[model samples]
Target: MTYRDFPMPAGLRRTVPGGSETGGPEAGGTVAEPAPAKASATVMLLRPGTGTDGLELFVLKRAATMAFAANMLAFPGGGVDPRDADPDVPWAGPDPQEWARRMDTSVEQARELVIAAAREVFEECGVLLAGPDAGSIVADLTDPVWDEERDALLSREQSFAELLIRRNLVLRTDLLSLRAHWITPELQPKRFNTRFFVARLPEGQIADDRSSEATEVLWAAPEQLLAANDAGEHRMLPPTRVMIEQLARAASLDDALRPAERVWPVLPAPVEHDDALWMRAPIDEDGNGLPPTVAARNGDRPQGELPVMTPWTGGPLNERVTCTLCPNPSPMTLEGTNTWILSAPGADEAVVIDPGPLDEEHLQQVLTDVAARGARVGLVLFTHEHWDHAQSLERFGELTGAPLRGNFPGAEPVTDGELFEIGGLRLRTVLTPGHTMASVCFLLEEDGILFTGDTILGRGTTVVAHPDGQLSAYLDTLEKIADLTTGSVTTLAPGHGPVLPDAAATVRQYADHRQERLAQVREATVGQQDRPRSELADLVVAEVYAEVPRNVWPAARQSVLAQLDYLDAGS
Candidate 1:
């Protein structure tokens, strides 16, 4: 599938008038400011998969009558109850103080979140996460007496701790493991700071759709659920969708619950443009984010400092740069296209790089920001002719009445080492054609920043976009950019994601990754020299790129084909 065809999880933004990119109330809108997120907890109950299934998670479809996330598939969870904060409740297993350290919350709040998770699991799914003692779990909870207690708990006639005490059971805090923490976006009417936990379904108990809040319940493999969601047959919130994607990486319940030294909270920032909304999650150069699964697998530990993330809220990045993030975010574009404004200090004329797509609101926002900075657009430039990076070229030039330059057919052709001056700013075009034939990188001679376009992304590797994108040329471009990094290029102003601090290291890493992929492709295609090109590409993908998701293999196939072509030409 193409980048546009890739499915993205639905966001939670409610339609509002005069909303800005960050979903804050606009100047003339009557919409009230969003309220703070209420503390909540959720649990993903897992069990061994049957037949060809992998690990399956217990999920429920919320009733359509609910106030929030109505008619959506979700794990059992709810907001923390006031009674959940009661320290007098009977408990067992891990101490609340230890749980506090794990969850990055206060001891009282950690106790409440864990209690709420257990309470909601029983209240919604008829599976209690408690046992008679600290070392054991309740094997069976199907008795009618248990049903009465669950009903009473759900109705608030009795607290979860009270139910546990009456049944002579201890809340099994050790059974649950932290999966993730997601805060609802500010654009949504209702917000939640939900901590997600994963736990094994007790041996002798079954999860039943017993709660009035849910319309149905089922056990589904994580991959199957993701496929259904991708096919539009199932609907889920962004957090739920991302969690399921993470769960798909695990082969068993033990793998899914592997303990991590630290888990970073995923706070998806909201960006709105031209009536379209997206939740932008921060990711690294490999397009990998702090998904709990990734963290757990690598045993990542929180240190003194974490990687810096560029805010989705459009604003000045520095004295010479300003970034206005577009609202279109997908698997390929982490936070959306970063429309950059470059100007020298105290200069009244600025240069706009990569106008980005044809979104009128984004184009207008760029102009508004430029005017706000007491500057007029002096020149418009393109890094390549790819629609995402250059579609708005003429429109922006029309609006700013600035001269346009790029490697495109009609625009002023920029050659390697070609220099342009915008006020006191000096930019030299460096031809870097790997992503697209026309791709180029701009060097800010004085600022030590490189406008890398798609040749280098802030949060992931760029696709060679085979046929139009040559692997040999792309490799050369990576080396060329890496050589420049040895000098003054300290920061990378990429077309997507954030501004990277280590430009040279990133370039070298990109080159190394490309070489590794090339070697893998060469090895995978060995002794298949007589095979059809299409067949060879498929074999390469199956053997070399087997771990990549099938949805992305189409693009991967493109790169694989490019690699094969490179190898063939070399031979």
Candidate 2:
């Protein structure tokens, strides 16, 4: 059946916002949606490339059975846990009160959410954002006391304040930067007021993904992976999908990082179209320091209000999300990420690329966009298997009754060179393995929009992770993309960051960067005694990337090991 006929889940009736729980038939049947809630704080983690080439991000595929965005790709983060607000969590960077004000939340709630972000990141991704002084109450991360203390906080057994005083640990509040904010939409049953914060991974610790809510995890370069997802190859969540699109627009992780330093104002999804939903550079109440397009659309119109929608205001028609990093989408506020709606010319139906994270409000927003176009989603496309890119695969498919499409080898694996048409646009899949064994790239034949999932990017090189990712395979993929330059493959629409005009040159730069890193790695290991892969990496990274943060050393070591393996295999 087409999406219009897709049956809603049992008990999935719309509700009026002001209705009583057990009153009128309308209350039990359907009710007006409540305004979305506003949340404070977003936490993002970054890892240096495991390969010698560039940086990557930690991502995970949420289990399909999850209540939130079932079977979607996502970064490691969630709402703030109560302990996050504890003053005892230890503050290192910015004050929690200031953070709350910047995020537009109460100081107490802000503290908790930040704490929760830190706690959740460690629990889900195996990366530690907390510092060493955890407390005399808790010996060390490995110590049983530490586990007990952590569990007590996680389980709500002990207050964060108690734990803080019991242990001398302090929260490194300075480490976090205000990245973005997203309010849940008014149409959905489950909602969250989420804050996005960006932080670099700690040095020496490896991201040990817990196989619970997240079935798998890995570090990936945005451009390369997004390229795959956009081609309907990889799956991703909305936030992850949009974040990568923004990352692709950056020239380097450093360039992308500049924005992280400034405190970003949190913007909520307009409850009613009449409610204001526009975002721009943070404004001071004195009516000064406003960026152009800051006040693009002000005034609560109504639910599903349409004002020449673009990625900056969610995304375009046919689920065509605009890259937040792109220059075209105006009055940009970090409402998470912008999604695109893809429609092939001459076709009545369209394909939804990067349905985005499994946010309840966002899902509704996409549906509104879809309804506005009077088009049904024919298929769902993923850039790659990264959580941020493909997290919403199942939900989008379920909601739209559209079949999932992609070439990556997984539960619903597609083959290389697969092509599908919708609304005059054509998405051709190209198997671009390296970021992961199943990575793929989609070339939009119509507009020269080549969606390279982690294969190529407008900025920064893609990482070649070991184990799941291989340097040899990634390099080969880069070469294959560069070869596209000889033909019509010109503009690159990556899964993460932004789109690129000179696709061929970008691919060439990626390849050269890898080669240069390889040379440095070889030189670093020339005189050192043989050591474990991780140990050897410590030596090599110090020589190759003295400029990168030290917290990413483990990932670097992984890259060096992958290279060593490639050399040993002589492939």
Candidate 3:
């Protein structure tokens, strides 16, 4: 219940070693039961200001020394004091019973949350929302007398109910609208069941950056703040970031005040991958990252930009198969690698393909899922040797003791067109190298889905990862995949990205993209035909990849080198 003023929990570091406050499960030891969440509240104070929507929000940069979410940009909020439930407190606007219905909490807890929201906003920003009566709001709170009262409240010298009693003021519950509820993930040392509120800036009163908890303060448009976050100026917690994103869609203050259809508490859990930890949380399917179930995006999505492939915990693709997405996300790994679990209807055994990155939590998740289905891992298969999809085989094999096969080290060698049967389902492996000499695809013959491992992807073209990836061999692999997809393979479940409906069409797109790149490379070598390989690769990247981000230019160069080799060999 009480954590010392440290950014990360001490016990967590002791057990998780390199882990931070991202709250990943302990790698080497048992984690203590998570502490209960303290009921808390925060408010997004809004007003008319610069930007397209003519709306701006008040924000504070928490002091770096804070125990939780240190140095993050946040709204004004604090925990509910036990005294906030005082029976004699002034009342106004919607009563606690109505709020209980709105906030999905007990009438008593709703009252406490509302009181905490008003009290913290006033205590932290010096702009009180209550007045002597329900009909009016307090104005001009910049005087020293008000400052003394704020200081008293901050130091707990006076409770919020006492301050309201002294001023003969009633809490303006109507001014605040319930926006969202977010519970801190259980992996945290300090957790909060936080109720979020949105309110307009009271007229004739100015908010000041006088809160002792904040080192800096600002008022910016929602879009501007998002741009800043994208540019890495200020870091925001997921809750705050999501709220601002919603606010950016507003055309006016009335649109901002519009009630939400529904609010669900989002709790983000940590998932480890790519030798690091990333937070995994659920998002609406239509809003942002269309979670890979999108059967056909080719006709819908824009030409150049890929749809937001938001990080997700993948779900069941059909009756016999499920994809558990790893929590790793990056430009290189779009929404992390996919780990497929295949079984028969009501079978007690399953086949797990690509256990994915050496994340202790992910491994446990896979095992838990297998057990949940009343099944044990009958076999483990790695599509390739790339560390992202293949490294955890040894640890996983130890845990499951299942047969290990496919392109990983110390696994049974897989030849082209080998059949791996499990749970009465036949999975035929088609050796489609190129991404690596060992890359392969698994055909779930019954379901008509081909799990393409890095040879093709859901979002964009697969990177032919240089010397290890030969362009000529990769082209052959694509052709082979295209031919096999016609008869029974209707869907493509790519190893790294989305699962699409038309497998054959996607393969053709990959082929077309490859040829386009080849043409670009040939054109780039117009006058520099005799240049060194490295120089030629760099030149091709500049000529062909000018529109792409510089961060990915290194990867583009590798692909260019492969194209150069393919071209040189042909000549």
Candidate 4:
């Protein structure tokens, strides 16, 4: 998308009332550099609105006495505390390492960001974003006793972690999904590198207007807030404005709380362009001219690419590993099929995995690369029978003069724990069948890298191709993978997208996501068990997957049907 950047003139009035001044570089006067942005976290607490309305977001008006964004409409948040980063904090939900990877920060920083978000929400609105355990949120915090705790927290008498521990509570970090990251413009005197998180307002918990920092607090539908901003009746910082605009698009609370496909850290800067001052941030190549803020919300921006050893066409990934990207790119395949070449250091023979679709050029490219490495193909392996990964299997076999092997028919079937030594490199097969009945993953024992073929994708969840692909079996398979290789596997070389550095965390997330989706599907289908199964699947998709793109719903429908089948069979 296109984003304009220009210098902020010294006297230009700020569009957002109560926002910091946009003055910088006074005409012909010495210019002062802006201060560094402090790390901060903000939470948008949301709940379902009355009747057919959408989500209502909790917003606060900062007290006019505040030094920054005084009288501005905003969410509950503030800078992180050193104690927030304490490693000993009893946490519940996704681990900090997973959050760290998702937020593009360190593990300690991730923990601190989550703690800051939850703590600030409680301090500003008297709503605790914590639970008594990993799976349950604390239902009520309106008692007078909680007021004392809140006061203690605000007064820094005890850290948030200490308060939770004393009360036997667990911070439900899982409830908070990162929505966006924004850095205040360079010209603003007070800048914050803020991460905005969205969370459902905990049930039975009332958000009181007890904060000394806020002049007012109210719950308003996102559309209403956006309308107020458009009419100049309400003032918000640029990041807040953008977040509200994005939230306004959601049709319901479920839609609003859908996990973001990607999070882009936007650093808006003022620059001189076209004889005028304007603000700009980097536009993603696929942004299609939408503003960077909007593009980020729409998931158009590529989050971050994996560290590639060679060009997109393929080359050496490391001293002993190489990969070639197949020339097929689509909505599902991401970049293309990844055909990896694995060999032991200084070895004369290598194993070729997932030769990919039967494209003559791609096959030739693979052969050329292998020959160039001076390593003859010793073993040709297939992760599955999927055309993207195995269509060229026979051709590859003929070209390399190596036997084809996999879990599929007409090849040497792979057994669980089956080991093979190819030129000093050790390989073992792990049966991971649910993406397809024949799907499998190969682990390089030496380096602890698992080559997962569609069982786990590089970016999004893999489709559980129904009929043949059962949801129950898939969940079991994911658990099996997690158990078999949690500590041993260091990286994941998937058939698509980028290589995952933390295999255990990624697998755990995948399992959690599936379980969450199953729960959602069950909740949506309750009391409709007597309906026709086919019609029920469509209904589940309509009710539970409203925010999913229409094009992908067909595939999602298959998954819903599988979940329904699993539920029905159990009942």
Worst-scoring 10-residue span by lDDT in model 4:
22-31
Query: Pairs clashing in candidate 1?
Result: 285-459
Candidate 2 lDDT tens digits, 52-155: 53568777777754544545667777655434555655666678778767766688877777777766665565555655453312113554465566566545
Clashing residue pairs in all predictions, respectively, total: 1, 107, 0, 6
lDDT of 2 at 471: 80
lDDT of 2 at 120: 68
| Every candidate's lDDT | 0.74, 0.55, 0.73, 0.73
lDDT of 3: 0.73
The TM-score values for the models, in the order shown, are: 0.49, 0.43, 0.47, 0.52
C-alpha lDDT (0 to 100) for residue 432 of candidate 4:
83
lDDT of 4: 0.73
Q: What digit string (tens of lDDT, one per residue) describes model 1 on residues 225-262?
A: 98998788888987787788878887677888765545
Task: Give me the runs in candidate 2 sitting further than 4 Å from their true place.
Answer: 1-338, 345-347, 407-411
- Which candidate number has the best TM-score? 4
- Using alpha carbons, what is the TM-score of model 4? 0.52
